[model samples]
Target: MDGLGFTVDQMAEAERRGRLFGLAGDVLQWSGPPIHTVQSAADELGLSAEEVARVWALLGLTVTGPDVAALSQADVDALATWVALKAVVGQDGAYGLLRVVGTAMARLAEAESTMIRAGMPDIQMTHTHDELATAQAYRAIAEFVPGSGT
Candidate 1:
């Protein structure tokens, strides 16, 4: 037994969790690029710290600090997309969309966590341990949506 007194099964399960956590980026399709700190993202995007903070909050998260590399490449890319969208939708409209999407995603995440905690398969609502690719998951969602016109 290890010093922590964890059984062999427990140790193996812990390692499995660690590996899955590491692959979360690939699961989420966050393969655009590496990330930067909040301050660096703000300066690079020509946005203010307050503005960046707001975006972080809208995504149902809080930035620990300006120097924390907590944001991902997709996060920065979304900021750039926001800038372009703001020109067309205006700030209020953009924030509205962000709020809706963020809240929806948060609920989905909670449901997923609950399903996992129950030791049930949640991916595509199947009972297999198959890992899902981000693109495949997106397509599944699109296909499931009624009147999505896809």
Candidate 2:
């Protein structure tokens, strides 16, 4: 057993699964390393940090402090979209819509994760255990489902 009390096989399996998840994140385009802090994003968009945090909270995401570099390009783009939406719908309506969409998307993401996990074959059964092959299989399954991950 390793230091964590996991067997070698368990560790290998965990590593393989982590790689697959990383590949999936890459394919999704929204999992890039964060490059913008809340303050930076607010400065770029000409909004106060509080407003940015509020929008993020409305989208079902945890609101980080202004200095945390937790916002990726996709996040900033989404925030920009929210700003535009708020312009049209006004603050109250925008918040309502964001809350509803965030909840629905969260549910959809959960369903998609379940479906993908179900669809993947057991690594031991395949006897391949190759990262490339596993990643291709994961990508195929992820793309096959028409959900938020796609």
Best-fitting candidate, scored by lDDT = 2
Total clashing pairs for each candidate: 0, 0
Residue pairs in collision within model 2: none
lDDT (tens digit, per residue) of candidate 2 on 28-145: 4444557898889899878998888887887788745678788888788877888898899898998999899889878877886676667666322254466656655665665554
When summed lDDT is taken over every stretch of 10 residues in candidate 2, the lowest stretch is 20-29
lDDT of each: 0.62, 0.68
Q: For candidate 1, write residues 1-150 as lDDT tens digits.
A: 144244566456535764332133232333343467788888878889778889879978777687876677777887889878988989999999889888987887677557543653333324434444432343343343234211
Q: Which ranges of candidate 1 are over 4 A from the true structure?
A: 1-34, 120-150
- lDDT comparing candidate 2 with the true structure: 0.68
Q: What C-alpha root-mean-square deviation, in Å, does candidate 2 show against the real structure?
A: 8.1
Clash count (model 1, backbone only) = 0
